[model samples]
Target: MLLGSPTVTREAAVWRRRLGGNPFTVAPYALSCRAAFRAHRGSFDARWRRLQQLAPLLSSTAAEEGGSLRFVPEAPTCCQAHVYLRGDAAALDAARDAVLRERGVRVYSRLRGAAVGPEADECYFELTLGPRHLEVADAVYVGAWRAFFAALAGPQPGGRKGVGDAEPQS
Candidate 1:
């Protein structure tokens, strides 16, 4: 579920109303991936670096509809960046699962089409972060994350990281 200030909630509600559906519930809504870090552990510098490092990886997984990463006001110490993707459920799910398995990043699927009517899916997932010393909290899905990252680091035929080289971590 989305957790934030009234402004953020209002923004989302506005976007949802304008779009006719909650982006989080619509099948073809934007895929927003947020990497939120703990407040007490890392400096802003460190969190910024981690956010930068993760952006490319997140974008690399976007579907044909396109994607982007940006910083927005969230909790005081949380380094929150969102990835927006527009595509089908399969494609969106693939991207979401990849991020989940790869970094255990906290992700929220939001956006609602104003004219899509009542069929929009309300199903979604959320992660609870714990205290950690790292810039970003450890992914809750450890096994998938390890496998995904390991595959990302896997060797390529010409020593180049192959596109889509890493399969979804089962």
Candidate 2:
């Protein structure tokens, strides 16, 4: 039987504290990573439709305030989805976990990282789909993230970034 999963663990919390709250550590130990995606070739209308489908699933106050959907998956993993947002990262992280849990889609918050541009620093929350046995969740996360990209911004040519079109990482 499948066992219950946790969104965040005390071990992770302790490690975070140990690293002085820096998401990026010098060691870079193995972590359950999620895949990131960019918008793919698609019509603007098609992209809008995909955004509509995703609007309810994801949590974004910016989108609610007549702002654009800024959720971008740019993590270096192949089994998680990363979202960048402004405002309380903790709250949004919890909200995301709750939303996915309600849909029976379990995920874990892997890391919170700094963004590149005008976005908030330490604003991105990387979420892993499930544990090792849940390869199906990994596939779903990849497909959904890809569709999300295709619908919202359209991924650039040459397929998804990070993982470099490689087979799923362990």
Candidate 3:
């Protein structure tokens, strides 16, 4: 389900990176994704509830209260965010692997993308939620998180280096 109210999609930059006006447009992206999710009715509604319930379970392990892991905005071009979860290095690594093995957010289908393993202590995964099956009042995040948590149940790849510094993994 949508985390909360929708953010504003303004003509100008909602947040200024240079000036340091952060935390803008977050609501709009979430709302847009929620809106898209709401269109499908039956499937979307169920999925949304599942996603909302599961997100906290996965995020419970987050290390930092606000950093080191979090969710990303479905919209907005200026800022990038992810639903972060904190744990030991090993735990994060395993979470990364679990996502890849499952081919979804936490364990199964949530958004429309893939999850890759970690670079090291830093883990990077991409979630590209589409316009279909989205809405403003609510959205699905748990399905994606399921795939994310599953990755943690294994080992990191040998050749995979710089996971944290690498580009988005979807």
Each candidate: what lDDT? Answer: 0.42, 0.41, 0.41
Displacement of residue 150 (Cα, Å) in model 3 is 11
Model 1: lDDT equals 0.42
lDDT of 1 by residue, 1-170 (tens): 67899999989888878878754576443332233324334465555555554444443443111332222221223444433333344534554556665456535444322223223432222222233424343343333333333333344456433225554588
- Assess every candidate by TM-score: 0.29, 0.29, 0.27
In the predicted model 2, the residue pairs found to clash are 34-77, 34-80, 35-80, 38-155, 39-154, 39-155, 40-154, 40-155, 47-151
What is the C-alpha lDDT profile of model 3 across 112-164, one tens digit per residue? 22243242334344433333424422223444344344343332346333223
Clashes of each: 14, 9, 52
- lDDT, candidate 2, equals 0.41
Candidate 2 vs candidate 3, TM-score winner: 2
For model 3, the superposed segments whose C-alpha errors exceed 4 Å read: 1-40, 62-68, 72-82, 85-95, 98-170
Worst 10 residues of 1 by lDDT: 68-77
Q: With candidate 3 superimposed using the best TM-score fit, by how many Å does residue 56's alpha carbon deviate from the native?
A: 1.4
Query: What is the TM-score (0 to 1) of candidate 3?
Result: 0.27
Per-model root-mean-square deviation over C-alphas: 13.2, 19.0, 13.1
